[model samples]
Target: MSSTCVSPALPDSKTATTDPLPDIAASAPTHASTLDWVGMEDISLPLYLAGQPVLARASAGVSLDAAGARGIHMSRLYGALRELESRELDAARLSGVLEAFLASHEGLSSVAEVRLAGALPLERPALVSEAAGWKRYPFRIAARSEAGAVALELEIEVGYSSTCPCSAALARQAIQEQFDRDFSQSAVDAATVREWLGRAEGIVATPHSQRSEATVTVGLDPLVPTLPLPTLIDRVERALGTALQTAVKRVDEKAFALANGRNLMFCEDAVRRLDDALNADYAPQGYRVHVRHRESLHAHDAVARVERRAPDNR
Candidate 1:
């Protein structure tokens, strides 16, 4: 029997939609492979560091331990960063954030890491004047949690003046030769020497000095209650003995010049000074020191580096 058959009327497409949204990352990957690190970087955020509010760039990541899983929950890692904004950054706080990352990932991750970078501003008083100005110290903090342990590291940059020892010696010799030539035929007297010293001809040459920078990275002890950023910076600057100044008056400039003259050093001297200071005073778990002297006498920069790790860590 030939009969026309009509299917029951179907629901409209708009009203019939009932499927859930797609989550591609929740599905198994086409190629199963464990990734070491996956997440976000250079994320701008506001956080408290060294007890001061700072705008920092953050990086959050976790290891993709599950081979079959397409990816870790990146949003969870990003969401965990909110803790940094609510509290002052420290080893304990960072460790907590990492723990949150692992908890959120559950079986998908075994390791988590967070990094923050920003400039710390401190108001510095002039060497011999009432003037004070802000000095910005660039710093980075990196923390990682794995196997129920947390590791923290801090890196900072300090600027100073470095006068070349060899240049100072050569300049002294030049001045001595000039003095000998001037006084060989004349009678020696305090007034005569003072007057000669006041003249430009007396000091024939000046030692070459240049602005230098020290970049120090140290592994923080887990027991440390707070990040020792200001203390570490003070130590580095004191070791160099000629920190760069802000809001300089004539007296401050003269004082700085005197400091540079007293602390004549090459890149090697600068690095060794920092190494000795850190070893004797701070005694961190591990540390790396790098000094760069931007040379005024030559086009090339002089640099020195030193690295040390505690015996147990090594």
Candidate 2:
């Protein structure tokens, strides 16, 4: 054989322009898709918190791995998020950013995700005082893309008071028995018994108390985008009726105590109430939700979760 021999079919003009189907295949080549997780993290940015322009920061994370890509286009992930920072990041703005992330990595058809978390302040309206200020709440915002679908989740932490119903009833019974015994003695008066029992150790015995918290996740409709964080917080606080306050006066403390007694709830009670509230507010419009309560009595925590089916996936 000669050292430089040409192939016989090298100049076959008959089959020069093979089938056009290979170029039109709407999928990646076999060896370009195999990354596990990719995206951004701890990227600081600003946010308009609770209707106020606040300099808030967040950790933005994303992943772009398809069925067979070796790795994601790392540069493209940053570029996509840069577009988000250039534009304001509202709920609507965040959804658009997710779309941009998917479009940036063409072969990444399966794994696409974004996460943002920051502390947001809530503007309080002075429930029991004259001076009005803001309350800061920790919020976590996350988004994910898979199979042409995207979702957003919000986690909010709120503080509230909870009184035990069982304790309250027992206290009332003890007070009644004291009055009856004082009447039988004919020397000690009912008022004296009340004064003695009103001491700290006497009146408030074994009162089960907890600072309740609620965590909710919602799937947003791209067509109609809005962050429901403020609305959700208000609903949760009202339902529980004993939220902890940053600024308080004597009058405020009294009102808060009254509220706690009126809305006494166990951990189970709080979860059920929150589940009902979320279903009524968000389920009909296509949103998923979950709630958790941190117990004060037991060492371990109590959690509750609920979800509404999406329109297409139902």
Candidate 3:
């Protein structure tokens, strides 16, 4: 009688199975809490910026204002980013994306932000040679929107050469000593001096030069029509003319050396020049410039920073 009590055969673990998927995100959270930002980062998306294709590391996020809501529709953000995959990111387009981010979760979020960062490849000509090459400049763009208000930020890193002022002065004094010692008792002739100057011993000592970086951040006023990324980069490079070079021939190297000598700058000089450049532009509401000279002589880098106070500020 006990053996006859077997029930109908049940499904085995080995059997193929498919069932309705769980929807946990829609379920109420165990502890309801508001989050400042909830979304994605380091998302890879292709972008065409300034007519060039860029593989951008894009991030999108939103504030969870509604504490009662279980969670935001994070997948919606991923889908919205697809709309920008093939587009050139501009201030207007970024604002639109932020708008969509908030609109996707009207009750759960009141603010949205998106950031896209990538290196932009630019064709560069040699200092004195006809050959040209490509160089990459890192660029970052961020836009935030809340309750129909929008703020945008643009950042780029510009590299240049900085020569030590004290080192240059010392180098000049050493050269004078070499000149006095070489011809102090001997007679001086134009050809003889030219031959000596062409020698490394004639130069005596060379000033220490370092590769320097300027991290420039600009806050755009709402009235600004375009992103003006190129313009910003141009300003920095123009202000600091001893920019990094790509192609290198003897002529190009000599030209670069000439440029570094002509634009002789310390870390403070570099920062002051960048500050002047930013002030000369009216499109930005505020700006922050950080110049760091990777000291060739010192283990630590020399740094200087400058910022402009925004009228509406932050």
* Top candidate by TM-score: 1
Question: Which residue ranges in model 3 land beyond 4 Å of their true spot?
Answer: 1-22, 282-284
> If scored against the real structure, what TM-score would every candidate get?
0.92, 0.74, 0.90
Deviation in Å, model 2, residue 53 alpha carbon: 4.5
> lDDT of each prediction vs. the true structure?
0.91, 0.65, 0.87
lDDT of 1 by residue, 1-314 (tens): 89999999989988897789788888999889999999999999898877778899999999999998998778888888988885777777788899999999998999999999999998888999998998999999999999988888999999999999999999999999999998899789898899999889998899999999999999887657999999999999999999999898999999999999999999999999999999964454889999999999999999999999865767
Lowest summed lDDT window (length 10), candidate 3: 276-285
- Could you give candidate 2's per-residue lDDT for residues 189-284 as a string of tens digits? 677766867765445444566776666565555454567778878888887777777667788878877787788776667767776777755664
Of the two candidates 1 and 3, the one with more favorable lDDT, higher being better, is 1
lDDT of 1 at 230: 94
Worst 10 residues of 1 by lDDT: 279-288
Backbone clashes in candidate 3 total 0
TM-score of 2: 0.74
